[model samples]
Target: MSRGFVKESDQEELPIIPPRAPLPAGVINYVTPTGLAALTAELNALEAEKADFPTDHEGEHRRAVAVIDGKLALLRPRISSARVVDPAAQPQEEVRFGARVTLRFGSSGREQTFQIVGVDEANVKEKKIAFTAPIAKAISGLWAGETADFRMGGKAEKLEVVKIRY
Candidate 1:
């Protein structure tokens, strides 16, 4: 009953798992239902096939598990907090995460709309662009009606920001 003593059965130390690093801030993470489903399916397939890995392939199997664990870890976290650059909680200024920016080309006069999202949610074909990409970099902090130049395929291409939305 003394505070400094414990029964031998209760003296075992509990495992202390190290915490993962905090996720990046100020980035929009938009996950499509299809993408999440695919990720889940892939993990499932890995689980189902994991039993077949031979003892000789233990290294490869562990590597595979690590990869799957990393993917699942990222996927498991719900995008509950969208830390945009909006101190007012109503962003109406420079490009920030979760912003739908409209770009207008100064040279060709072409315009396009893109939603800036995190790396996991970026699909150029779907127009959900990654904030760290080259094209995204060109327009990340630009304001509406502003033009920015990009070099692609050895040619200088022009882009302009026409609009943005949350």
Candidate 2:
């Protein structure tokens, strides 16, 4: 029972499972129809990967399976909780979920376009932002030519809605 009696082989490194995109508590898991389809495709791909896991190298296969399992565990709940919202169903004149918005910064007079999407669907590189994002929240429900203030890193930035599209 002494610590000195324990064997080094008994100790093993634990697997690290990466966290998924944040979805704050009490917030609905809203997804665009395209977003839902993407998630479903990812799940299917993961399943196929797991099924084809190589068994020749026991340790490699085990580690691979563990990683796949971790991803599936996180993804399953999000998929189940998803509420699909069609972009075409949203108002074409006002910014809302699944709306592609064009904004102009008041200070710099620079224009940028971004689409408001679900958490899992958000990718800055793709010009898609989550509905929960500060910029998205500030402009949501706003119409063209409307302005809203957003605070970023202790500075307030004014954003003007230049255009909205489904």
Candidate 3:
């Protein structure tokens, strides 16, 4: 059992598993129905990949399976904790989770539209923002024609709600 008797080739390197998007402590894992479905799909894909690992090279196969397992380890809890919220069931009169809101910047008079979604589903390229984001927090529960002051980095900007849709 001495280190002098151990071989370097016998040691297995742990695969680096990337962390999922951050959800602040004690914050409920709220997810849209679509977001939940996407998480489930990702879990299924990882399971399939783990099962289909090639066995031609034993070490390679083991490393590949370990990586997939690590990913699944992180993903499973996220799926399990998901609380799906249906966009259609949300109140349409005010901005809430899953609401597609259009806002006009008071200073520039430029309009931008984005949907408030869960942390896991937030994608700026798709015009979706996390509910915990500063702008989303500032505008939540506001109705069309209402204004909210969004402050970031010690600077504040006025945002006017131009439209709200579920």
Best by TM-score: 2
Model 2 — which ten-residue stretch has the worst lDDT? 6-15
TM-score of model 2 vs. true structure:
0.93
Per-prediction tally of clashes: 4, 0, 0
Q: Using Cα atoms with residue i matched to residue i, what is each candidate's TM-score against the true structure?
A: 0.51, 0.93, 0.92
Residue-wise C-alpha lDDT for candidate 3, range 138-161, written one tens digit per residue: 999999999999874577889999
**What is candidate 2's lDDT per residue for 1-166, written digit by digit as tens?**
9989987645646578898899999999999999999999999999999999889987678778889999999999999999999989988899999999999988899999999999999999999999999889999899999999988678888999999988
Candidate 1 clash pair list: 102-162, 103-160, 104-160, 145-161
Residue 70 shift from truth in candidate 1, angstroms: 7.1
Best-to-worst ranking by TM-score: 2, 3, 1
Query: For model 3, how big is the CA root-mean-square deviation?
Result: 1.8
Clashes of 2: 0
Worst 10 residues of 3 by lDDT: 149-158
lDDT against true structure, model 1: 0.62
lDDT per residue, candidate 1, 1-166, as tens digits?
8956876536644433334323356544444444345445755765666556555765556666566555555545633432323322435777766677887766677778887665655777978876667787787677777777898778898887778776
Candidate with best lDDT: 2
Can you give the lDDT of residue 117 in candidate 3?
97
Worst 10 residues of 1 by lDDT: 79-88
| Candidate 2 residue runs with Cα over 4 Å from true position | 1-10
